[model samples]
Target: MLFAGIDVGSTTSKCVLLSDGEVAGAALVDMGIGTAGPERAYSEALAAAGAAPEDVACCVATGYGRASWKGADLTISELTAHGLGNRFLFPEARTVIDIGGQDAKVIELDAGGRMANFVMNDKCAAGTGRFLEVMAGVLRVPIGELEALAAQAEKAAPISSTCTVFAESEVISQLAAGTPVPDVVAGICVSVASRVAALAKRAGVKEQVCMSGGVARNGGVRRALERALGVPIVWSAQAQLAGALGAALHAWHKSEGQRGEVKYG
Candidate 1:
C-alpha cells in the first residue's frame, strides 16, 4: 500500500510518498503567508509519483505547522518524525543536529536507534536558517552565496553577540571598519555553529553525528560545525526531507496495524 507524509514547517512544507517501504517521490515548497504550502507540497509530490491521493492508504502530518494540515489522518511531533527519519537514513547515527528556519535541535539516539535525549533552541533565530537570512540582508549578499563567500575568508572576524539584532550591528561595524565581506560572512557561519554546538554539547553527542534541515545544505555551516564538534559530520541529499519520510514510515506502520486488526476482527 502507498502512504504519504506531509511536514508543514514554519518556512517550508515538505511531502514524501512511500510505495510500500520505498520512497517514491518527495517535494518541498516555501510556505506562504497562509495555509496553502502543505497542500501544494502534497499535490506536487503525488504528481511527481504519478499517483493520486486515493492511491495513498494513509497520510501523516508533522512539523510546526502540522495543525494547519487538517487533511492528515494523524499528527506527530517534529522531534519524533525527525528521529525516526534520521535513524532510517543513517542507522549508525547516534546524534542528530537539525537547524531549520526558526529553530535548532540536537537529538541523541540510543544504541537501539531510539531517541534518548534532545535539546532545542527556539528562543531566538541566532542559530537557525532565519539567522543566516537576516545576516545576508544586512550584508547585502544573497543567502545562497554565503557559503561561497565564507570559503574565501582567510580569517573570520569575531562576532561577540548571539542576539540576531546585535549580530547585525556587529556585522555593520565590521563593514564600517573596512573588513572584507568574506571575513564577516565566515564569522556569521562560525557564530551559528558555535550556538548550535553548545546545544549539541548540552544534549551530549555520540558517534556518527549527522545534520539535517535546510541549513545543513550550507557547506560553511557544516565546516564550522565539524570544527566546533571536533568531528566529521555526515549528511545526505535527503536530509531536508527526513521528517516527512519519517511521517510516511509511521503511516506505513500504522496502516499495517490497522490491516492486522481488520483481519483478526
Candidate 2:
C-alpha cells in the first residue's frame, strides 16, 4: 500500500511517498516561507508519486510543526522517526547524530539498530544551524561559502561563548580585528563540532555512526566533526529525508491493519 509522511521542521518541511518499503517520491521546501506548506507538501508528494490522496492508505506527521497541522492518521516524534530511518539506511551504524535547524541530537543505537540512549539540546540556539547562520551573516558570507573558506584556514579564532548572541559578538570582534574570514569561519565550525562532540561523548558515541540532518550537508562541519570525533562518520544518502521516510513506512504498516506500532531496530 502507498503511504505518506510530512515533516514540518523549523526551517523547512519535507514530504515523502513510500511505495511498499521504498521511497517512491519526495520533495523538500522552505516552509512558513509559505502557507500551510505541510499540507501542501503532502499534496505535492501525492502528485509526484502519481497517486491521489485516496491512494495513500495512511499518513504520518512528524517534526517541530507536527502539532501545528491537524493532518495525518498518526503523529510521531522526529526522534523516533529519524532513528528508525537512519537504521534502515545504514544497518551497521551504532550511533546516530542529527543536527537539524533548531537543535542537535546524539542517539546511541544497539547492534540491532534500536535506540539505546539519546540526548539533545533544545534550550538554546547554540550548536544549531541558526548559530552557523548568524556567524555567516556577521561575516558577510553565505552559508555555503563558509565551509570552503573554513577548510582553507590555517588558524581558527577562539570563540569563547557558546550562546549564539555572544558568539556573534565574538565574530564581529574578530572581523574588526582584521582576522581573515576563513579563520573565523573555521573557528565556528570547530566550535559547533566540539559542542556536538561533547553531547556525543555524554551519550557514549561509538564508531559506525550515521549522521542525518540538513547540517550534515556542510563539508566543513563534517571535517571538524571528523577531527573532533576521531572517526570517519558515514551519512545516509537520504539524510534529510530519513525522518519523513520513516514516518511514511510507519504509515504503511498501520494501514495494513496492524495496530501494533512498528519499532525499528
Q: Give me the candidate number with maximum lDDT.
A: 1
lDDT of 2 by residue, 1-265 (tens): 6778888888888888877566777878767324667777777777778888788778898888877757688998888888877777777888888888888988888887678899998588888887888888888888879879988898988885368988888888999999888899989998888888888899997879878888888878878888888998988557888888778867876777432333322
Count of clashes in candidate 1? 0
lDDT of each model, Cα atoms only? 0.88, 0.80
Model 1 misplacement above 4 A: 257-265
Worst 10 residues of 1 by lDDT: 256-265
Taking the tens digit of each residue's C-alpha lDDT, what string does model 1 give over 106-157? 9999998889999999689899999999999999989999999999999999
Model 2 spans > 4 angstroms off: 32-35, 257-265
Instruction: Please give the range of 10 consecutive residues that has the lowest summed lDDT in model 2.
Output: 256-265
